[model samples]
Target: MTKTRRIPFVVANWKINKLQSEIAEFLDNVNSKVPSQTVVETGIAAQDLFLADMVRATQDSPIHIVAENVHWEDAGAYTGETSPRALKDIGATYVLIGHFERRKFFNENDSTVNLKVMAALRNGLRPIIDVDEDMSKYAQFMDAEPSVAQVASALAGVSVDQIRNITIAYEPTWAIGSGEAATSEQAQKAAHLIRQTLAKLYSPVIAEQVRILYGGSVTPDNASALLQQPDIDGVLVGTAALDPVKFLELINIAKQPSMPGQFDTDEV
Candidate 1:
């Protein structure tokens, strides 16, 4: 990809960890120490209860606030669930759907995830869809590697417009929180498959424009190597993102150059 074509994003999934006070402090540190905007597009996915505070904290900054999960209904009796409309009303721009933890604990199936994706789009919020990573289950159900093709098929019931508005995050479930990460080769292979699947589902143009992020045990020490992969457009951080200093360091590392011929445009 050309320099002008690069779409680098760094997303922090706060999960259900921080308290309101901790959220304020984290926002303050991120606002005060974040590097120049040219480096990467930054976003934070906070818990539902803290979405308002996060939105308030990032008002005048480039940082975008995102919710970790949202329900398909606009407003309903679904207790303990966040409404997509409410999230949009509070200035949230993105919602993470089908994360590993959500699928594992809440029993979120692909159909439900598809509904949430549609709801996010209807409310004018972008959906960052995490393709479920149960490789063992996937192997039992399919013959080929679960690429973007499978993801597209799962959401085939939706229209092409919704597909365009979505960003695919390729997080291998096994690597998450295991202090292990996909090798550059492994990441490239998966990301390339994602893009290829998009090309087949829609068009090459959309595939080229779509952003694919890597998430799983990512840290400052290993970010540069991962970003060097031509297909790896950005990263979705977890535990490391909890600390301001370490998060900033990971951003800086993502800006460094990789091995010489690794990113040649011709390779794409």
Candidate 2:
């Protein structure tokens, strides 16, 4: 069966930033301006303290409330950890797992990422799994081992049916928060490699059905080129997303249809 085209997903990862008032203002500025989820899906990953409020604020909007992180266990005594169940119950529909920063600073590894992915699925939260790659490996994607290996490991016990809900993000560790973004060609190569990895893990048809995003210093200025990549379904934005106007601009760029010659149905 021919699958429907993947909807562009523009997610803002507000890592440890934004106060309550700021959050409200950001929402107020973008809520009605955001395109419909059907046209271009939008999400905001913020601090746990603000998720419920965000959900409430976007209740009439199509913007999905996203959690920055989630704990593996649904109900656990892991103090300070945000349970997946709690996140779902509080109205968060998506959660970022194994973000490069989390793996680098909080000791989040393949094992923990896998646990959280499954946990989020069990509790009805979509997992936007972030896989960071080295620029050297990304250049010669055929030898890109760590990123592919991380994808395989993260979905270790995930069933084929559950895979449909997964959205893999390719964020090069070197470019994140550095004000340097990868060239569009480089980003496309990385996203294609990730899709190829998905094909190997499941099937080409299933792989084509999956959504892959590129992160690391994505901005309105660079987004059009990046979004033109056939394999790049959307962007996991950072610094630039903090500004509502820029965020809306990025979404508007995504709203534009893919350019001619960008094959959406190319076989894996």
Find the candidate with the highest lDDT and give its number. 2
The stretch of ten residues in a row with the least summed lDDT in candidate 1 is 259-268
Write candidate 2's Cα lDDT for 1-268 as tens digits.
Answer: 4436688899999998999999999999999999888788899999999999999999999999899999999896899999999998899999999999999999999999999999999999999999996545545656443247788899999888999899999998988999999999988888888888888888877788788899999999999989888889899999999999999999999888653212355433
Give the best candidate by TM-score: 2
| Model 2 spans > 4 angstroms off | 138-147, 259-268
- Steric clash count of candidate 2: 0
- In the range 160-188, model 1's lDDT, one tens digit per residue, is 66666677888898889999998877777
TM-score (all chains, Cα) for each model: 0.86, 0.94
Q: How many residue pairs clash (N, CA or C atoms closer than 3 angstroms) in each of the candidate models, in the order given?
A: 0, 0
| TM-score of predicted structure 1 | 0.86
